[model samples]
Target: MATINVRRDVKDSFYRYKMPRLLSKVEGKGNGIKTVVPNMTEIARALSRPPSYPTKYFGCELGAQVKCDDKNERYIVNGEHDAERLQTILDGFISKFVLCASCRNPETDIIIKNDDILMDCKACGAQNMADMRHKLSTYIVKNPPAQASKNQRKQRKAATAQTNELGGGFENEEGGSDDDIISQRINKEAAGLSMESKLAQEDWSEDTSEAAVAQRMRELSVKGVAAFAEDDDEGGESKYELFGAWLDEQDNNTISDDDIIAKAEELDVYGKYKACQVLVQCIFDESIAAQIPKRANLLRKFVTEEKHQKAALGGLERLVGLEYKDALMKKVPGILMKLYDVEIIEDDVFIKWGEKPSKKYVAKDVSKAVKKAAQPFLEWIENASEEEDSD
Candidate 1:
């Protein structure tokens, strides 16, 4: 299937994170004309969003009624709409709900918390408020995400179990039911309890002392950077899986240089070029252009040899080219310049990465876009080197 970038505003032909080009089929005569989106499910999966969102959004934007039949996998907007018009409307939906407000990355989860909608970015770990003014917010609130729906089912099941237990057919010695016996017992106990005893039962004071905190940390078994216990006893996890798990446990915005280094060392993957690749992808976010300079010393520890530099570049390729393509593709040159200035990455590294697009790190198209974005910076490096030789 032909695909285009999710963010239609991105003009880069090689941009990653693409969804199927919207296909609309208009059916029926003039008065009863309706547009059907046959591939809404595929598009929604690519956007990491629900298909109903875009379908309903089309109705809201065009002031037309929309029908979303999930079981049948059919989405219809009431009108004779063309593909171009629907695609343009989809772009608006992506901007307002799909992309993270802070980092502009589309890897976000739409959550309804306390009747308000929020977009939680997997890349930046920022919880941004979604536009509540939009009419779709009401629909989203009424029908929360699948995770929330599952939680609700669990709650209902628990409640049913409790009801079954209390309303069971067990008869007491006095011929009363479990519910009646339990109610009478509760009333008797409440009459007998003193105010001081009730107060003791209601004690909610937490143990916040230093010793208590130390005990909690010990129980967590903090061994360097591993959040939970190692899977060595489980006996199937590879070293790379272990490293990946540790990285997954970390919060991108707050992970410090010391923790990254300590964890890498503890895992005995400190000097491995592959480790550098994993580190760069997991630690950096859309703010990577600014973060590169700040973490120059840390990056230097990993990006020493040309091979390590290449691995680091691969990480960046996946991060910017694929993860945050729309937001970071244009900033590739400045990011490369920052790395060069900080001495973490050399001129040769840029030249080598820009020589050709490789599918080693990201999709071929995405790699091409990133390399293409670095052209201006690569040219400047060559010009500077020529001037130095002349001097």
Candidate 2:
């Protein structure tokens, strides 16, 4: 069995055109017991989203069981007979038909078989298949079914395999055909590139100059970066465009370095939440934290993102914990007081480092710099506790 990700555009086409046609065929030809095909739209939708998201692909029991589509008809279980046609159907899907990302092939005859972890590949008769996994993940990434490479298409159309000068003969390596070897190599290269893309693009070399950052900061400060709250649309992207105009004001050296920080300050206030996020993110490239606000205006957005927010807080704590420990501790109470009064959804969101709470502790320690903005948050947590426990 194989799984492939269809490009979003290809997916849209299938939903808008191909799938409807397939559905029509099914509807028109139904006699008594309808042999219904799985809804490609439902499959595509499930596969397109993130894993933890609601209504996403939990897993597929498809291709694992050899069963008939007709629920009414008493169909005989015929895994072997269906395998070839199912493979052909899935091949058609990878060609133009939209397919699910989780083991898409209809020919797949895998079974749970009492919680067995190992998937013994019925097609190649291989166990513990790393190569097969690579093939599946690679197919899922490519999405919109691509034209078979020119060389591959030629090989497929070829009647017989003949030896080439470079030892890529028709008979190729042990057991597999030349086409199979080519496909494997192509898959390997594609997988490597895919991995490279997924990695966060951070350039944290100590030697890199902060010139670009300073210049951009100057632009943002002057033009004023936009900062729209997530809940507040203000007709979308109002924050980023203002900052972009500021960036456009400078070409190479149109702005002077002496006033760059000043310019960045001006841009900081009006930037969009999304743009502001990027501006703060730019510190990874430009370590000149002095170019931006001493106060973390950017920290407001940290509450929304689960992973990045944790990274942001932990990194800041590690940084400030060592450098300005005495000053941070002095200001901690005030900050927590302020934070407690603010609209934080979770009380523990303001928790700081160096303090260990009980294993089942809920709210953060109240007297911290982070909580100075809202001290009432602690009281709110206590009040909410009763409601939560009752539920």
lDDT of 2 by residue, 252-282 (tens): 2344432433444454432223443333323
TM-score of 2: 0.24
What's model 2's lDDT at 361?
Answer: 14
Q: Which candidate comes out best when scored by lDDT?
A: 1
Model 1 ranges off by over 4 Å: 1-237
User: What number of clashing residue pairs does each candidate have, in the order they appear?
Assistant: 0, 44
Residue range 171-200, candidate 1, lDDT tens digits: 444222346445445545665787658878
Error of 2 at 326 (Å): 19
Q: After superposition, how far is residue 91 of candidate 2 from its true place, in Å?
A: 18
For model 2, state the Cα shift of residue 310 in Å.
3.4
lDDT of each: 0.75, 0.33
* Prediction 1 global C-alpha lDDT: 0.75
- The candidate that wins on TM-score is 1
